[model samples]
Target: MFEPEKMKSKGLKLERMANRLSNAIEKANHNYEIEFEAANKYL
Candidate 1:
């Protein structure tokens, strides 16, 4: 017995979680790039 609405919501939840993870990764990379540039300026 599969519930269509329940399945749909589950998919949406997974998608939202994945999107959050992706955004976090992007932010981390951006911060790292900024730090690297700052460090390079010291050399």
Candidate 2:
């Protein structure tokens, strides 16, 4: 019983970390797109 509870807690921690990493990647992509468009206008 104690073992299952510990496993569940570890799973939740991994899920949260994956979510944070994806969010950061998405924000970085958005910023890059904005910069690329602005650079094109100046060219």
Candidate 3:
């Protein structure tokens, strides 16, 4: 027996997790870019 409400909640939970992972990756990449640019100034 499948419950529609449970399915919807599970989908939403997965979506939220995916979004958080992507945001974290973007923040890490942004920080890396900033550090790289700053290091370039010394070279």
Candidate 4:
């Protein structure tokens, strides 16, 4: 017997996970471009 409250909690957790993933990708993209550009000056 599944309950509605449990389902809502699971949905909330999934939403948080999605948000974290989005933030991580944005951060990686920003850092990668910045770092590469900076490194190019030395090479």
Candidate 5:
């Protein structure tokens, strides 16, 4: 049986995980940008 409640719960869990992954990626990108800017200043 395909249960609507189970599907919804699974969807919510996936969404939460995706959000965390994206946040981590954003932080990494921010750090990379800062390092790039500093390197650029030295050039």
Candidate 6:
């Protein structure tokens, strides 16, 4: 799902931006998982 070369060829700034976006997405996924776990507690 990740294309580092495609990101690199775009631009250094783009590459960094992509990396930051990936981190943000991962954080979001973690938050979602935690929320799901909390919700499941009463289920």
TM-score of each: 0.71, 0.68, 0.70, 0.66, 0.69, 0.48
Tens digits of lDDT, candidate 3, 1-43? 9999999999999999999999999998888433466677779
lDDT of each: 0.89, 0.87, 0.89, 0.89, 0.88, 0.82
Off by over 4 Å in 2: 33-43
Kindly report which residue pairs in candidate 4 clash with one another. none
Q: Write the per-residue lDDT of candidate 2 for residues 1-43, one digit (tens) a residue.
A: 4699899999999999999999999998888433466587678
CA lDDT, candidate 4, residue 15: 100
Which is the winner by lDDT between candidate 5 and candidate 6?
5
> Where does candidate 3 clash, by residue pair?
none
Candidate 5: residue pairs that collide: none
| Candidate 1 per-residue lDDT over residues 1-43, each given as its tens digit | 9999999999999999999999999998888433466677678
The weakest ten consecutive residues by lDDT in model 5 span 32-41
lDDT of 4 by residue, 1-43 (tens): 9999999999999999999999999998888433466677789
Judged by lDDT against the true structure, how good is candidate 3? Answer: 0.89
Query: Pairing residues by index, what is the TM-score of model 6?
Result: 0.48
Better of 3 and 4 by TM-score: 3
Q: Following a full C-alpha superposition, what root-mean-square deviation does model 1 have from the true structure?
A: 4.6
- Any idea what lDDT model 5 has? 0.88
